[model samples]
Target: MILLLGGTTEAKEVACCLEAAGMPYIYSTRTEVKFEGKGVSRFGALNKEGLECFCFTNRISCIINACHPFAHELHHTVAAASLNIPKIRYERGFPERAQHELVHYIKDYSEALAWTENSGFTSMLALSGVQSIPHLRSFWQKHRCWFRILDRQYSKDFASRHSFPADYLLFGLPQEKEEEVTLFQKLNPDLILTKESGLNGKLDSKIEAAIACHIPILVIEKPELPRAYKLVHSQQELLHLFQHE
Candidate 1:
């Protein structure tokens, strides 16, 4: 049996493939985002102890990590938990490095905030999600900047605590290229801030949005992990690894 600690589409696909292959497996997700399959389990918060319990309970041998980037702590915990259990990470291909000559790439959020403020970006769109809000709040409060987030994910106090103007667009985005262009036209933002959540999270929409808006994007780079096996964007490679073993 295989234990998959996952929350992405890729993870769901892998779980489906494993099930079709007649392999027993369990899929773990922090949210109730439904995946079509039999015998798939969901966990609101997955931790090391829970992982061990699941593995032992099911007599599973291998652990698959389908979590996206910024799940650094989860990655380490999984690695440490598996002394005898083999672990595999289902990673999509990295983003194509399309260098924007006008855009500046920062090492982390702090650097991105500092550079955006120092660069005199009077108005900015904080599409880095609610997670990036705290870091940017200080500058926004002092600068009287503008930003937006999903109304479903955050509270009314979210903007109040941060001292930024709160307005809920509640706009549902389409995944088409032309639709992205239309959304970009609607936003008319001067700048966009986002993370490198690989290609799974409608990332192409963001890049296309930035292009259509003719604005610069501040992408937070992923860190180099320690003592890890890496792959270069190949599902066939992943298939081979799982199939041969």
Candidate 2:
């Protein structure tokens, strides 16, 4: 059985490929999602011991990791657990449009905050999501910050629990460059903060808006994942890997 750690779009594609190939597999996600794949699926996180037990019990022959790029901890856990079993990392290709002069890339959130402190920026609109709120809290106390979170009950609850001011929160991801431009005009922010979520996260729209407003945008670079048996950047490569391996 193949153990497919799936959550991203690539994961869904991989599941579809596996189904068509008539390959026995188990799909797993960190959280419960509305999965349409007609195969065995499991929800919830698994520690090293738990993963090892699952691999052993299910006779897992291979592991295909198709998780979010910024899922650092999960990546380490998966790499550690796949020492004996063959593992392939299905990563999304970086968006070609991310290359530009106005876009400043930083190593991590801490660096982003440090740079913000030195840059003399007063107000910022963060498109980096809810996970960034805690790190930006101190920065927020000193300057104006608007955190855009998903329009979901869980996201709202999490933000509320963190005591993020209701007024400082913006819901929903911007679907178009014009929508982002409208936000920039209304906020008149000194800076825009985001993560390198690649093309899938619609980072281009954010960049376009920032450029239109002549605002500098700071991006937290995606962390490197551990080297696996195979690393594939597209669905075709992933499917080809399964065929050869």
Top of the candidates by TM-score: 2
lDDT string, candidate 2, 1-245, tens digits: 99899878888988998898888889999877778897799998998888999899988998888887888888888888745878888877676545677789888888888888898888999999898888888888788999998787878888888888889999987558898898899999888999888777777888888898889999888888887648888767877876786
- CA deviation > 4 Å runs, candidate 1: 142-174, 229-235
Model 1, span 1-245: residue lDDT tens: 77777766677777777777687777777655656677568677757787777788888888777776767777877777754766777776566755765455678878877877677776666656555667876676655444445454443456566655655322242255677667557766566776776676666667766776688877777655535543424456666787677
The lDDT of each candidate is 0.66, 0.85
Worst 10 residues of 1 by lDDT: 167-176
What lDDT does candidate 1 reach at residue 154? 42
Point out where model 2 deviates above 4 Å.
97-101
Candidate 1 overall Cα lDDT vs. reference? 0.66
Position 92, candidate 2: lDDT: 78
For model 1, which pairs clash?
Answer: none
TM-score of each: 0.81, 0.91
Q: What TM value does model 2 have?
A: 0.91
